[model samples]
Target: MNRISATRSELLARRAGIRLAIQGRDLLKEKRTALMREFDRLSADAVAAMQDLEEKARRARASLSEAVALEGPEAVGSAALAARNEIGVRLTAKSVAGVKIVDLEHDPVGRARTDRGYSLAATSPRIDTAAEGFETVVEVLLDFVAVELSLRRLAEEITRTTRRVNALEHVVVPRLEKERDFILNVLNERELENRVRLMRARSRTDERARQTGGLAERSPA
Candidate 1:
């Protein structure tokens, strides 16, 4: 009887364990889904930002080349200085879906044209044009770097979360469930055997009592 009771208690405990494991599996799955969605959105945004930076860089280079050819290197330098003064670079930090991105600044300045319509100090038109063109290129590169880094970091985090979810769903949770089931089955079988044994014992006891009563009556005392 004691063994049977112990088995019954074990079965109850196993059932509880199964319930907890199942709940954990469900929660982890939800978290994985959310992380995947975030990863997708972030990846898309990073691609778009890279394309925009590239396009802008190309246009800036073209403009610088035209200005240098018309006015000379001196004019290009003046324009660059002016652009820098007019529009200074400003940085601001931003967070997207728990990922942090440093803010970027884009400031382009054009130099004033000389009386002769040439650059003030530099005479090489090609040199001036190249310098102007590179300013835009530099900005584009910076933007690309920021986006790429953020994307890489976000991807890493996503991968980590996914692994954890898979582990819980495929390995940890299943093992727990199997063990719980085994315990319950063992408990049930033990209890059933105990019930059968008790019935047999009770039957024997009743038969013995009846035989004793008959003997006592027949013996007349």
Candidate 2:
């Protein structure tokens, strides 16, 4: 009786375990799908950001070239040096959904520009041209850094999420399923044995009662 009871208990436990494992697997799959979709969206955004950076870089370079052509090299160089002293770029980190980005600020470039910006002290046209080119190069470098950092953060987050999903699907779910099956098999065997024993005991009790009646009838009463 005890064995039968234990077996029944084990069977119930196994069934519950199987149910929970299945539910967990389904939930993990859903999470994985959501993460993948996010990764795709981030990738698209990164591509667009790169394109925008490139376009801005080209514009900056062209502006510098025109400035140098009009003024001499010496003039442009002096302006660039003055701009450096007067202008400052600062980068600050901002977070969005656990990702961090460098936000750049140019303090001097737009701050002091009157109707006509600071005059270049020109020595030669070539030098002026080079000075203009330098400004464009600086702008391009700043844009590149921002885009690269953004992409790096996104990629790292995607990798971390993927690893967690794989672990749930391949490791945790399978182990739970295997344990549940083992418990079920053990319970079924115990149940069958209990049934057989109960039948045998009932047959013995019936035979004893019949013998007692025969003895009583045979005696001189």
lDDT of each: 0.64, 0.60
Off by over 4 Å in 2: 1-35, 59-76, 85-118, 121-151
How many clashes in candidate 1? 5
TM-score of each: 0.66, 0.62
- Flag regions of model 1 displaced more than 4 Å: 1-20, 56-119, 123-129
- Scanning candidate 2 in windows of ten residues, the lowest lDDT window is 108-117
Please provide the root mean square deviation of candidate 1 (C-alpha atoms, Å): 6.0
Model 1 lDDT tens row, 1-221: 22333455666675676677668767766665765676677678778877877787777677666776786767667655643433466666666445555556655444333422444465555544555566556656766665576667667766776677677678876765666667667767888999999999999999999999889989954
Candidate 2 matches the true fold with a TM-score of 0.62
